[model samples]
Target: MANLLSLFKTSGIFHLTPGMVIMWLISLTLIYLAISKQYEPLLLLPIGFGILVVNLPLADLMKPHEGLIWRFYHYGVQWEVIPPLIFLGIGALTDFGPLLARPGLIFLGAGAQAGVYVTFFAANAMGFSVNESATIGIIGGADGPTTIFLAAKLAPHMLGSCAVAAYSYMALVPIIQPPIMRLLTTREERVIRMKKLRKVGRLEKLLFPIISTIVIILLVPAAAPLMAMFMLGNLFREAKVVERLTNVAQNELLNIVTIFLGISVGATMNADNFLQAKIIFIFCLGLFAFCVSTAAGVLLAKLMNLFLKDKINPLLGAAGVSAVPMAARVVHKVGAQEDKKNYLLMYAMGPNVAGVIGTVIAAGIFSTILK
Candidate 1:
């Protein structure tokens, strides 16, 4: 009988807690969504697996003294390595052709970041430090890797929740952005038609990343690593000499890093750290940031229209959040509603990628000022 009692104490069943079970279920839900519904699988799959690992009874996924996940995290995230590496993949895939074809859209990217600062001050009001608030505000930019990079640098303690929120919301951009787009811009404004972009010369494409890196790095050297990696990838693509390197960077490299990043992020969501009042507040603030960003993009476009002889389809402004292809697609779709012939996908790409660059710049700013 005493031996039976001892066995029970050591059993996995006895070690389970309600919170663990709940988290396990949540993880499973994320996996299911990734599989069946096809929502952000590149990230959700690893995050779900990480959640499963961490929530298991006596699993030391986050045990600082010794944990597999924790060790991976220390090497991957805390050291500020993987996020910038992913930026290489992002840079590889990005065609700066659209952006170079239209330089004015750069301000739309910069203007959208107004939400980042607004959310930061508000977070400081709510008792978060400068770094923590800055991390929280970046959610509005809707660029996942930038959020991960910034949070890792400024507030590693909040990495798991902030990353999850950032990426999860990015995946939900279709749901979150449209409502804000409609609220901020009128149907007529959304219907405005943009002219075809000027054909970009291959030379301009090659020159863009080189010139941008020099200018932006001169302005904010802290952004050098991310901005440099991103520009190098663009240069590689434009050089037309390293096709294989570009392919690997765009696909396999991105995929592998995404899996590791997701799992590492999900592992950070253990009960003690995640189930807090601040987590809820983080979600709210992130949503606010996204909306404010969308509004800024639209409003800024309206301001630009005042001087320009040719009008821009204001709906494309929403693409300034930097979710890349997704936000660009959203702009195209919304524009098509007004006139099927008025597709804005290529034009939207300028702000789409610019948003990514803008977010990195904002992260550099926050890290510099706060740190």
Candidate 2:
């Protein structure tokens, strides 16, 4: 009887605590969102399942040096291997034609980075360390892999919270961006249409990745890992002879890494580390960062219209957040609402793609300064 009772005490049911229960609920919520809402299901599903696995009593899934999930976390995230590979896939999939046709839109992408700086100051004021503040601030950039990379390097303790905040805000881009965008721009500004983009030749497309890699790396060497992989992927796509490599990079390679990355990141969210006042603070600051980024992009576009002969729809500025195609789509949908004839998707893509580069550069700058 004594031995049986001792075994029972060691059982998961006997060991469960309020924190564990709460984390289970959180995990379930993430799973529900993934299945029902189709919100980043590829990532959220694996992450949510990981959360469930790690939180189970006596599972030890996140225990250092002994746990299966820990191996994933250590080799992929702690070693800093996954994020840059994700960037490689992004590069292969991206089309820089729109951005090349309108080089000035890069400013809009740059301006959107204001959110990162502003949130950094706010996080610091709220008593986070410089590293933590910077990690939290990068959530504004809306680049999930970049956010994770910076957090893993600078503030590993807060990696789970920062990553969750970044991805959650990214998934909610449509919800978060439109309100701020409308507040910042007039209906006329939203509906303003510009001239058509000029055609970009194959040579320019082929040279862009090479030139950009050289120039950007010369400016920020710390950014080389991500920049190199991103440019390499782009080169593979534009090379026209590397179809197999491009397909592998963009599809199979990305999918495999994403599963490992999501599960590993989620395992870090063990109840003890995740359910804290600081987590709440990080989430609130993340939303602020995202809103500020969207507004800054729109406002900068409005500002530029003052100097340019042809007017740019301020709505395109909202695409300056590095949420990629989602931010661009939001700009298009909002513009279409204001004027049914408005077709802003392609125009928005210029700043949208530029925003990806801006976020990476911003991460490089932060890593250099803080690390």
Model 2: per-residue lDDT, tens digit, 41-67? 888888888988999989998889999
Score residue 182 of candidate 2 by CA lDDT: 92
The reply for model 1, stretches above 4 Å from the true place, is none
Q: How many steric clashes between backbone atoms does each model show?
A: 2, 0
lDDT of 1 by residue, 196-215 (tens): 67889989989988999999
* Model 1 lDDT on a 0 to 1 scale: 0.85
Best by lDDT: 2
Q: Top model by TM-score, which number?
A: 2
Clashing residue pairs in candidate 1 are 140-289, 140-290
